[model samples]
Target: MADFGEILESIGDFGLFQKLLLFALCFPNLILPFQLSSLVFNHADTNHHCNADWILQVGPNLTKEEQLNLTLPRLPDGSFDPCKMYVPMDWDLSAIREYGLNETTTCTDGWVHNDTIYDATIVTDFDLVCENTNIFRAAQTIFFAGVLVGAVLFGPFSESFGRKRATQIPMVLMLIFTVVTGLSPNFYVYLASQFIVGVALGGFRINSIILATEWIGVAQRSYAACLSQVLAALGQVMFLAVVYFVRDWRIDQFIMAGPLGFIVVYIWFIPESARWLLYRGKTTDAKELIQKAAAINKRTVPDSLLDKALEEKPVEKGGIKMLFASRVLRKYFLTITFAWCAVNLAYYSLSLNVGKFGLNIFLNQLIFGLSEIPVHFFCMWSLEAAGRKLSLMGALIVGGVLCLLTLAVPQSNYVAIATLATCGRFLMNGAGSICYVYFQELFPTAIRQTATGLGSTASRAASMLSPVVNMLEIYHFTIPTVVIGSLALASGIMAFLLPETRRTELPDSTEEAEGKRGPKLSNPATRDCEDIQATKL
Candidate 1:
């Protein structure tokens, strides 16, 4: 019986069909940054001060300077205290400038936001300042909480219902929730919308991989995986460009959501995974898609090929249980999950906390987005040359070390600090790209999505903790970076323990995953590693 790999070899592997497939699959990734990093724009706190109605009473007739002098208390820096104002007492409008009120209180009426920075934001609109700061973190946490839930749900969903539907359902929901978020009239509604958006995004994250990687050949799989990640960087640039002009948070949401809606129509062009169809005993369906693919790629397939490809091989029921049942599988599961958690935590730590760098945040964000582009090319070269395990470890170790070194760069030299941070961001982008391909390659096809989804759950769990870590600036400045950098370092060391999957045929069954894979195991030596360590027992 011919394996899927054999069938791919018979026809063109990197043919026109696969190239088109790669492009179609990248759209979701391009939109992902909006849901992932929109918090940067949405949660921004514009300059503000206490809004005392009595001050306005004096301000209707007085200049702005006189009203601020009478109503707001200046901090040590001579800037008005946003959270506090002079208590309204015995203020004569006739001599407002002369009237002095010493007693100060929290802003009881509301805040006067500086519209120049943002028309309105989640922070400014909802008053997430002062004692309510924790609520802001809670809101960000709730979004990742939804992603954690999705990590559990989408795995089995992709396995059972098929990858195309799995991809479509979440995409449609993402569009709907994003649109609703923009239209949200109140804070609670926005929170709910964000949670739902995250849920849908989680669904997209898992299914997009299944759709993209399942169709490509092993040799060029790294290219497909890395190129898809480049879209994530592209999405960040798009977010900046859109928000640069559309400063209103609601309008920004609207602009981002619009493309997602249009994409729903275009996704119809993307075909379901033929490999998944074969896994489910839908051989006829798989053959039909393969025929269509051959036609699209302008390749010829023998008439008997379908019959040989349909030859049955026993497939195990792979899930969370199957992963832990064997010692080898258990080790693989634990190591990858922890690696995912550490890498994601470190990656998002810098990605989310752009404000803490003490630089012009917009420029910092632009640089961070730009930094990831080179990483895609780096992954393309390194994953092929050094193979998966070596490249992955290199990225994790380097990214972690660079992030830790960021602490040594004095904050006074904002440019130096920002440069080191961008380099850290660059390395993690490579680490993360390799991890995405590694997750799919590591596990059995039967349970691959489930295991990948579970890993995603771990990563999202780490991401959920990030807001709290980022919030730790109130207690200590270095703590968040320390925690994430430590995680990256630890995970990088653990990367050595797992089996290398580069150039190895993806495991099709739990038994295959459990079986011994000495360096000489796989038949294809074209792209397999030279050293025994790449496929060591």
Candidate 2:
């Protein structure tokens, strides 16, 4: 039985065919950032105060400033209290001013929103303020919850049905749901629509990585993975381009959905994973696709090589049960999943808190997108040079230290705090990029998608909790930093437990995953460390 990597090498691994396919697969990443980071804009905080228009009937001639002064209470800073109002009484304007009102209570009428920063947002439209402030976080959490659900469902779907269906169906669903989200009349409707959009996002994201990785050879898999992430970071920058101009959340949704319409059509032209076809015993289909790829690359696979490939019949074992049946795989699953969870937890901790940096929201967001681009580019080299384990571990541990150092900086020095936070974001994001390639290479093709999906599930679960954890800052300024930094440190320590997959082909069976076979096929030099580790285990 010929290895898939050998076949990929023979058919021109990173040639014209693979490049075109990778381009098609990576294009959607540009749009995904809109949905992923939309919360920052969609629920942007604005200046607001309790409505006190009830006094307007008696004080018809009163100026807007005088009306607010008479109808609202003041805090120590001399600003009108945002959530409180003075009790209204039937009196003339001059008489009301003469006799001061002492009683204060929560706003009986709805709040008035300032539209200076954002023309409209879910926060303004729904009055998600004061008592309802937590609702915005809840909605964002629900969206990530949907991402978790989609990952759970699509993992088996991709492994059983095929990667093409997993990718295309979600593209269509994301398009439909994004439009639905934009047209949502009520906050509840918006939440439901965003949840479905998240579901579609989860399905599309994991399978895209798997399908692209499966088609590329071991040597260039780093390029395939890192470049896709670089594109995703560029997508984040593109998100700023769209949102910076269109401030309304509804219009933003509509604009972001526009690109997916063309991508859905173009995606159909790309072929399915030939490696997946062979693993499923669809040799005829795999053979035809491989031959076509060869023709496109201006190369040829010998008939004898093709004959031997068809003769390779894999024993099919898959699903969640198969994932945990082996002890070594279970260890890999737990370690990688924690790495996924920790990276996401720390990543979103900084990303979602873009406002605290004391910079323009659009500029801060641009800084975030720009910073990630180079981190991924660096990952492209370090993943191949220092190897996966050290790269991820070093990134997380160093990033964690930066996050903790923010606690020592004075709150008045926004510049210093911002600098530490930005550095942490850079390292965490780099670790995240490495995980996409590292996780795919760690598992066999039989349950590879399932493993990836499960890792995504764990990451989404962590992301879902990130907003809640960030909310802890209300209790103590240092609470969120302590928690996120601690998790990053622990997760970096856990990375040492995972085997280094550098210069190793993706395994195709449990036997190969367990080191019973195929390790020698890629590089005996690299496999020695893995085999020795396996023996000790």
Candidate 3:
């Protein structure tokens, strides 16, 4: 029986066709997140705040003149005078206005505001300050909270079903909620819809990362993973374009919702992971998928090789318990969880605060997105040569240092701060992609998805707190940057403790990974001291 790696070797390595397939599948995942961000950021409530609307509630007994006197400016200078603003003392008018109210002219003399009429309407109900700070924060918190739930569920579903199926289901759900979100009649409904949208986003995000890595050869896995995120960055850039054109949040949500229809096209072209199929005891299906992949690469598959690839070895059914049962596995799990949390904390905190950095919001997002192109290439190069741990450590350290530097600068030094922050973003982005690929590589195949899902959930959980942390105003910009920097530094130190995995074959089982027996197919050379210790039990 030929080795599975050798069989893959028989096919072309990272050829044009393989790259094209990955590129097509990666494109949608990348674009979808940014489009979703539009829904998050451009809602009517969000825009009203951005536009500085100070909505105030006033009694209906107040004439239009009186209402205007209370809300609108009285001075010729067109500035509001808070001292002169007054509202009617009538409780009935206040109650009606609070529920829904309309006005009509009185026949007796001057116009009289009527409180009896009821009309349901969507109106900005908060002052500009409340809208900008509290409302926006609420939206961000809810969105990520949904993401946390979806990410937790993403792995189990993907493992139970298949990668392609798991990946597409979220897109369908995202399409449904995104369209409905735009049509939401009230703030509560809109918020609820965004939460659902976040869940769909969580599923799509995890599957996209997993599937992208699964489809490629080991030699190309690192590069493929980095490229997938590069596309994500591109999605961020594309969002700027979308936001520029469709300024309204509801319209933007609809626009984002519309492209999801294209994801249905993936059902025809995207193939399930051959590796996942092989692991799931669907060897024949795996072989068939591999053959189609070979065909796409213009290669032939031998029947003998295909049959050999189908033969099963003893493997255990993995569950969440297996992740923490062993010392080595426990260590990897903890390291991955911390690293994921740190990455997300810094990544999201930075991304969510880009508008505060003095660059135009659209241009800031564009710059941040464009910076990722080089970061992805740099990550691919570093991971392929220097290995995973070092790449991650470098990224974390660089990002942390830059984040700390932000504290020393003033708003007047906007360009300098932007440059530093942008560099930090690049490093964090690259580090995150590196971590995703590295964490998956470290786990045994049986529990890979579970571990990945757990790590993703941890990251999302940490992300849920980002908005709250970012909302802190006491220390100005220093507080958030300091917190993000400290977390990154901690993650970098923890990363150093993880084992190096460059050129090392992925472990097939926990026993093999622990070196319980002789060297396995994946690692056939002299055993290290740690391997011997792991095998001793």
Candidate 4:
């Protein structure tokens, strides 16, 4: 009888079957983070009780004399009339009093007294404003920033430690911080917890993606990665139901954080990446993991295959410096970095702002999340059949153009503009999903994780600016939309300059990558001349 390792080696050496299995294993990890985005968006609302009656009643009820008193605070020139302070409809005095609204002073004082409770409730209602939006955006930025750090460090760490141990560390952290986030008593504590969670979340994201890719064959890598995100989108929808039922942000946080506890159980079910094991010179462990994988797949492996796979081990341990060693590698880095930045800017800006559009915030988010299913399939089909560059360019151009057209739709045409904006969102979401998979394929195994992390960091840098851009856009929608559109268009054009990777085997080295298309790879350079030229145009 063949041992488990021998069976796994016969499964076509990490092809479609392994990719599919990895997709299944990695699905939950992907969804958990994306769904958390919605949780943050939901909680970011500051104006949840805006329609609460007591809040409205706190304003001056304007008896003839009181109305005159209200007018007294105005400028003598009548330019700043205090009487113009209008109460919005739907504010409930009863709800305010029940929640401890002080009726003696205007409702404002009382509202501020119970601000935390009210804020928490309103966050559920999805009325987040500037401060809240900033907090939410900041949390996401820090999270991605953590991802950047993790991606860079994880490659080396995973190389030294076993891949299984490296992957589990983040999962453990995610569980711990997630629980801490729920128990946070104050905003500062909550923010800190989120930042910590970001670190864990970041690690989990990179490890899961890289591990899944490594275990699969090149032919199936793109589909596997894309499928992971697709399941993540499904998780987004599932979380909608979770948020709807849970209602409280803290409770929702706990719900999201809790699932990670079970992931540890995967230790028994999931095997370490054979590639990482091989690279680390642990032929015995690598062979063991491969055998286990074959057993899971119900296949038999031959002993001869395992003997043949035990190849050369390096004399010197390779570090991240290896990523920077060639001109072509540098080019790949720059292209992916800029591309990720543009994709993230457009992708996140739209996701963060979706609540502002005139639709039921929860329902709209659910719809938006669900839209990714079909859109992802479209992306997969287009990417496989059409060139990656062409598909990406088309999506970017369409999304950018649609965003620009949103400016033409009058504010009075809120419904029409919102519909158009959603279309733009759909395009960007699909494009972004494709870009993640595409970027992975563009780089070789040596620097794949490093390249991804750098690209992700660029994207995070862009994301850090998104809140500022969003705030600016609030003053005038047209200006920000135009800026986003311009960036998207530029990204599409930049993509045109990069080489296509479809049907080509992944480049073994930076020098090989450059030599395949345009340039000769020399010593590792910090920046690629070609990428600089593309950006300059």
C-alpha TM-scores of all predictions: 0.94, 0.95, 0.81, 0.77
Q: lDDT of candidate 4 vs native?
A: 0.62
Candidate 1: where is the Cα deviation over 4 Å?
Answer: 94-99, 515-537
Candidate 3 wrongly placed segments (more than 4 Å)? 1-3, 43-85, 88-133, 474-477, 512-537
Q: Write the per-residue lDDT of candidate 1 for residues 1-537, one digit (tens) a residue.
A: 566776776566789898888888786688889877778888886687788767665557767777787788888998888889888876567665665788889988888787586777888778888767568778888998888887778878999988888888888888898989988888899989999888888887778877878888888888666887888898898898877777788888888877898889888668888888898888888989988888988887787877887878566774778888878888988987898888778877788888667787788889988889888988998887888899888888888988888889777888888888889889887888888888888888888888889899889999888888887867888888788888888899999998777676677776667654433233446545544555784
Q: Candidate 1 — what's its lDDT?
A: 0.81
Estimate the lDDT of model 2: 0.87
Better of 2 and 4 by TM-score: 2
Deviating ranges (above 4 Å) for candidate 2: 516-537
Better of 1 and 2 by TM-score: 2
Count clashing pairs, candidate 1.
0
Q: How close is candidate 1 to the true structure, as a TM-score?
A: 0.94
Instruction: Give the clashing pairs for model 3.
Output: 42-249
lDDT digits (tens) for residues 22-67 of candidate 2: 8899888888888977988898877999999998898788898998
Q: Write the per-residue lDDT of candidate 4 for residues 353-470, one digit (tens) a residue.
A: 7777777677677877787778777877887788677888898888889988888877777687777777887888777766777766676555665666666656766765665677
Judging by TM-score, tell me the better candidate of 3 and 4: 3
RMSD vs true structure, all candidates: 3.7, 3.7, 8.0, 9.8
Task: Give Cα-based local distance difference scores for all models.
Answer: 0.81, 0.87, 0.71, 0.62
